[model samples]
Target: MTQQHRTALKELQKLDSRIHEARQRIAEFDPRFEEVEEPALVLEGELNTTRNRLKEMKLEERRLESSTVDRRDRLRRLEERLGSVRNLREEAAVSAELDMVRRSLQNDEQEALGLIDQLGKAEQRLGELEEAHAEALRVLEPRREALIAERADARSELERLEGERSVFAQGMNPDELRIYNAIRGGGRRAAVAELTEDGACGNCFGIVPLQHQNEVRHGQSLIRCEACGVILAAPEPGSAADAAPAEASTAVTEVAVASDDDDGGDEEE
Candidate 1:
């Protein structure tokens, strides 16, 4: 009964650990989902940046046009005043100012033209980014849906295993369940371990006393390794099976010697 209960507890511990892992796997989807959306996010960002740049270029073009218009108006006023200038000094000064304004207007117009070219490129790039985003969605849609479905399945399995663990725990002794749950919840990989070949705890590699080994081997008593609190079970059946051949060979030798002794006695008779 003790060994049976311990076996049940060990199974419970495994189920709990599996449940933990499944939950972790489910949690991993958050980042993975974000990763799937990353291409669209990048495209949207690029499109927004291009649009903003285009706006700035257009604004600059408009400003340059306005400046050119203002300069032209000033030049016209100065030219009108040139006809009224009586002295050569006034005429020369007015002519120099007109040249400066004309040059500024030309420069402004050239800059505006350059801004229009930039705006055209930006608009084209924005269109390309939009198309790329749409294409990415088309390509990744299936993968994203698959990921979502996988996460859902994993979550469902986790829930089912959690239910199974609860049901399994009901069959274990309260004290043993408490101990197992404590060790398992405390981050230990296993709450129960099989005794190893050298009579060490399978989990902690701590030496187990012979007396405890004997108790576990009988399969009638529960034993815990003293060094580590994990419950111990007897070594599995393979070790005992390995000794069977040696015992068979010894029996065959004994029969041969007995037969030789009988033949010698018969000869003496």
Candidate 2:
């Protein structure tokens, strides 16, 4: 394997990982994505609850009204009986009965009035809830549409990236692909790294010893960083030529092998 081939392999690994991650993310959001009809579902449930409450309140008002009518009919019958009284005892009994009926009618009227007040307040609240519900639906419509459009665009982009990744991966050996996938399984970043001007792994920024750098440059075999366990490659000719002197000068001045243990840390997706 030449250095160029290794670099291409590394780049292909990176692209493949990116494609896989994008696909996973898209899958997660497929069923209940923000772009779907979530807002409509929420609004529908709320509207149904409010309408049910309104229906119950109206039924209660009708029941109260019927009770009031029944009380009025009783009072009318008692008033008629008062006229039939003939003796003092009978008249006193009839008068007492009339008084009781009047008191009962008054209580019924008061209760009816309270019910009317409550019904009015309930109607007003229902209207407010309806208005709020309408406004929420109105606000949610455009947002939902926009999200749907965004998802569509993302899907299209993901498709294109996947195609590109496929093309790149087709050129790589199965063993290379396996290694790349193994690294990606641990985290989002798949490729270990290439060498930088400072003789360090580009991904981990850990120092690459002179021997390791030569191995990576020669491309006799695939190389992985000892510290970070990332595959390493050399930069392109133009960059490598420019980097060679700085690396040589640093190595001469330091007179000590740079530690491979110093890691630059993992790259994020």
Candidate 3:
């Protein structure tokens, strides 16, 4: 591969990493959207439960009303029998029975009144719950749409970056592409490392031999680090230089602009 191809590959790696991160960030927001909607969902569930309870209470009120009617009819029959009593003993027995029936009727009436009051209170509470549910929906509706729009925007940007990355990668040498893919597939963030000022591998911090360092600076051939198996490239321009190597190994001044991982050296002035 030409020096230019290696240069393009380096730029491609950086873009690829950025695209990956952008997509990851967008994916992360899915849960956030769900969280935003949770309050409304919870309120809806509560409202449904309350409405169901109100239905059951209404049914109970109807049952109580029916029972009250039955009791009143029984009281009327007892009174009519009292009027027909012929003897004093029978009359006294009828009076006692009449008193007992009156007490039962009064009890039923009191209970019916209490149920009606409860029904009124329950209806009021139901109205409040319904209003609360509507308000919750109103509050979140716009916020939810905003979040959705934000996600759509992020996705669009991710797609654009991906397209740029694909075109950039296509310009890279096939051999370089295979090597980079292999390193990335192994879960390493950087497929290549730039040598440090002190001639150390940027990824593993392992020292590189003076001879291999020269080879990376020239960008003529791909060189892998013996210690970490990462493709080694020379540091970028403007990086701090260590004491100039003794004359015997001083020829590696030119930088190849080769691919490096996010571990790109902090270039020193």
Candidate 4:
């Protein structure tokens, strides 16, 4: 293949890797979005439980108040009976009954007072919890909205990159495409590797032999660094001296291929 063709193939490879990375990022956010949902649901449930408890306490307080009124009425009737007693025995009996009714009233009143105290405290606590719940919803609502928008944007970007990658890959040869796919499948440092001054692979930083470095510079043959296994491209001429060897190698490969084809035809005839 021509040097230009090789360069185009490398560009396409890089684009394809970017597309894959974008898709992976979108996938990662999907679970994160769901993770946020669970906490919101849990908080809602807790708020509902607090509301129900508050309602129950209020109902209990009302029932106690109603009972107190009935007790008070009974106590008044017992006191009137004490005043109407005719003899010592009758007076003692009425006095005992009145004493019993008074005790009952006192007990009911104390219980009602206690219930009121409890209800007041519970209502205060409920109010605080409601406020907290409101704040939580307010905070989480915006975060959820932001995350939703982020996910949508990521998906859109991923789709666009994928379409671009498809276009990039259209004219690439199968072997070159395979090498690109293999590198991308490995990690983020796929397809593209920088040339080092010491003729080492940039991705792995391993020392590349002089022979391989020369081959990469020529840009005619598809060259991969043995140590890092990244596709090596020659740097533009006059840009840096480190890239000269690889560029020369690319030229050598092109000339060799041309000569071999010519010799083979002669032998076949």
Highest lDDT model number = 1
Give the alpha-carbon lDDT of every model. Answer: 0.75, 0.68, 0.74, 0.68
Q: Residue pairs in steric clash, candidate 3? A: none
Residue 176's lDDT within candidate 1 is: 75
In model 3, the runs with Cα more than 4 Å from the true position are 31-35, 62-115, 239-252, 256-269
What TM-score would every model get versus the actual structure?
0.76, 0.64, 0.69, 0.56
Candidate 1 per-residue lDDT, tens place, 1-269, comes to 45556556656767978998998999999999899988888888888888888888878887887888899899999999999999999999999999998888888888887888888888888888889989988988999999999999999999999999887777567777787878777878888887765667988899888788767655456577788788886543444336444333332333233333322111110
Best by TM-score: 1
Worst 10 residues of 3 by lDDT: 260-269
lDDT of prediction 1: 0.75
Q: 1-269, model 3: which lDDT tens digit per residue?
A: 24454455567778878888998989989898888888878878877887887788788878877877886887788789888989999989878888887888788788778878887887888888788888888988898899889999989999999888776676566777788889878988877777777788988989988788777767667888889888886665544354333432333334422333333232211
C-alpha positional error of residue 263 in candidate 2 after TM-score superposition, expressed in Å:
33
All-Cα superposition RMSD per candidate? 12.9, 8.6, 6.8, 8.0
Q: What are the per-residue Cα lDDT tens digits for candidate 2 across 1-269?
A: 24445655766776776777777766766665544556656766766776777688678768767876886787687677777767899878877877886787788678768777776876776677678767777877787677678778778878999888777766655566677768778874646566787788888788988898877766656788888888887665454546566544433222122222232221211
Return the TM-score for candidate 1, rounded to 2 decimals. Answer: 0.76
